[model samples]
Target: MRVLFTVYPNSLAHLYPVVPLAWALQSAGHEVRIAAHHSSAELITKTGLTPVLLGDPDQPPVRLTDDCAPPHHQDIVNRYADVMGLSPEGREHWIVFYQWLMQPTSDYVRLDRSEAEDLIEFARVWKPDLISWDATIPAAAVAAKVCGAAHTRLLIGHDMFGWSLDRLAENESALKAAGLDPNPLATLIRPLAAKYGYEVDDELLVGQWSIETMLEGLRLPTSTKKLPMRHVPYVDPEPFPKWLYERPEATRCECCGRKNRRRVALSLGESTRRFIKGDWDRAPKIIKALGELDDLEIVATLDKAQLADVEEIPPNVKVIDWVNLPHLLPTCSALIHHGGIGTYSSAVAHKVPQLVCDVEGVSLLMRLVEDGDVNKTGTYRLGWEFDEREEGAPDAATAHWELPAKKVESTVVSDFVISTGAGVRLDHRATTVEEIRDLVWSVATNPCYRHAAAALHDDWLAMPSPSDVIPDLEKLVVQHRR
Candidate 1:
């Protein structure tokens, strides 16, 4: 079979999930190549996969946008929430964060007619047997329908897209039962499908079948044909220098070979330093505070902007710009990071406890925040909560003064910390440096969180490997072929 893998091209986090499957299919004697926008060309090439670049790098990855997102994007989530009777906090979480995480498939953002036209042109020429896309890039569905290829959605994190679409259908059914006109999510979903002369259905977003790496018990509810694949932690294939593999105290006495007083991994994601124009760059402050933990060794990954602000590098803390997380995480007792799928998945694979500081930059939607001073521009739950004076809102039932405390701990917070049962969530706004120091020390010293993380890792390890699913995927291609 000839397979075409498609993605929105902005995030490697989204792209990596599909690579293992691609490799599995390729090794099984199928032809495989990745199709993405030009921005992702270098990364895809480095992975040693063939790439079909869809558009010029000069244009915005998604061609059309307004002051914020295109109107219909919000319409999809809004209609789903309204028909489902979701609470305001629920609505905001879906709209501002969860829905935004599905960026590649952001109908208005990723699917202008031009990108669709480009994809279909390639599909017509390539004549692939299957077209598998990352969860958000609905344009691939259009290309598949036009070119007569079978397709599937390869998921990166939670199936929030599938879960939301399922609720949309159920809610519409309930609305119909009550004699109210159904709020058709299809309104926002159908433009591209209709443009290609097909009506929308569950497969438009979720695909004919889908592949997910998250553990079964932790998945959001979905009605799609979902399959589990054991997550193989994706890392740089190039070998690391020998020094990184040695434990800090590997040279200690032979009797005990005493560990270096428990090592902790401290890494705030790229967004923490660059997002919000640097207002939430907590790396320096956090490192300085964690430095106070005299008995522990800290390995922190920080950016140049964050490195500039620190007056002293603590004896117990090591600050470098970057290290492969797969290499760093397993050596550590715990992780402190932005709640990205990459870090969370790595932590899960290594059975390391985490401290999710805040979730920003995962989504692109902005909301009218009534309590924060920004009111109109705070992009995600963590973006606005950094404001010290934000007041809790009764109408929304979100923390005003203490967002992590008041609101439902934001989408990414629950996804990374609470849902996984691996670590504590902090309202970073209310959590002081000393408090963070204490919390990090406790999570690192305590064994309960590690036990929970281990159980979750065990479940993940029990799932089928990518090669194990190749036969299933081949069978699906034969069944779903146009």
Candidate 2:
């Protein structure tokens, strides 16, 4: 069977997962082609797939330029800037930020439509058996509908788009424009059947649409009569550090190759960029705390701007501009991160304890730690808290104190310290340069965290392969043809 895989172009996240699935289909003796933004053509080609460029070459890139203060400092300006110009007002400031957040997908949707028009022109000449699309690609469903082909959504992280459609029934207008209804399952399956001029039984659509509903509906196995749905497919690169396999037996740190070296991985998501940029002063304090540690090597994944603000590169720290984290995280001791779904899943896949720094919304980190027996496995929890000072409480003390004591909270503080578990709860108030030094020494000298980390690593390595969870792709092709 011949298949056309579609993705949104902007960054590596949308492209990476689709590659392996395309490769898997190709390896199964199916012809596969990929369509994406021109910027990502090289990356798609690197995956050994043919690239179909999606947008006009002369079109300008979507620029998210705004005049307000950076995100970290938004709270400071937002409090007083209400009296300022319209651009600086708190309400207007958030509107700009929200627009920036949606810019990538919004821009890609325009390109997807342009690309789909081209694909429709192409399909009139060369037909494909099926069309598999990344969740971000807005046009693939429509293209499949117009071309009369099977359509399937290949998820990378959580199904954000599908979830949004379900949560905000207000998206009915957008769905209608895309030829879908408010019903997610029908929104997905009906288009393909209509395009193909075939009568699809509701049962087959339900069975095939399991991946979409299982995740979006938030229905766990015990709560529903439906069979457990397969997890999203991920291609794990091999030749991983042997310690990941030998875990409890390999009593040494994988990165430093030292039994004395304490291992921890810091996975920075997009939210970290927002918080760090908003509060520029906190960078120095974070650096000072990191610098004091001799035994601790802070492996931080940061964006270009965040890396620029980091003045001194301490010997104990390794900064990677970008990396394949899903490949690198399994060998780490613990993870410190902003709680994005990708980072969360990587930590879970490795079974490593996590320190989540939630900068917005209700504290997801606290909820997870409180609900689960995380302390037993050594997961730590901490978050930035904010309380508006009434009148004149105190002037800003230092970079550390500028955040104020009321602005930070920990749910499982004592459990982290006394439990001898796999995680450490770094108190934002007390985590001074000197304390960070001592904690690093303790983690390096102690054996408990490493022991637990290794045990968890081995268990993850023993789980069923991601490929095994789904029906064979070869079988899907045969069934579709029949």
- The runs of at least 3 residues in candidate 1 whose Cα sits more than 4 Å from the true structure, single-residue gaps closed, are 63-83, 87-93, 96-113, 173-185, 249-259, 271-274, 279-281, 305-312, 358-365, 368-421
The per-residue C-alpha lDDT of model 2 at residue 106 equals 43
Q: Please provide, for model 1 over 1-482, each residue's C-alpha lDDT reduced to its tens digit, 9 standing for 90 to 100.
A: 99999876655666776778888888899999898877678888877788888775676455222222322244455665676787654565556334455432453323443566677789989889999987656777777877778898887776767766655566766767655445334545577677677887666766888887777665666788887887776754667856468765433435777644778898766443432323243555677778898777888887665565567789888887778888888778899876666777788889999887664323334333435543222233321222221424222323111112111223455454667678976436666889888998888878988998898788878899899998888888888887
Q: Which TM-score value belongs to model 2?
A: 0.58
Looking at model 2, which ten-residue stretch has the lowest summed lDDT? 398-407
Question: Could you estimate the TM-score for every candidate?
Answer: 0.80, 0.58
| Cα-based lDDT at residue 274, candidate 2 | 30
Clashes of each: 8, 7
TM-score of 1: 0.80
lDDT of each: 0.67, 0.46
Candidate 2, pairs of clashing residues: 71-278, 72-278, 72-279, 73-278, 148-195, 148-196, 385-407
Which runs in model 2 stand beyond 4 Å of their true positions? 60-104, 108-113, 123-125, 168-259, 270-283, 326-331, 360-466, 469-482
The residue-level lDDT of candidate 2 at 99 comes to: 23
lDDT of 2 at 171: 49
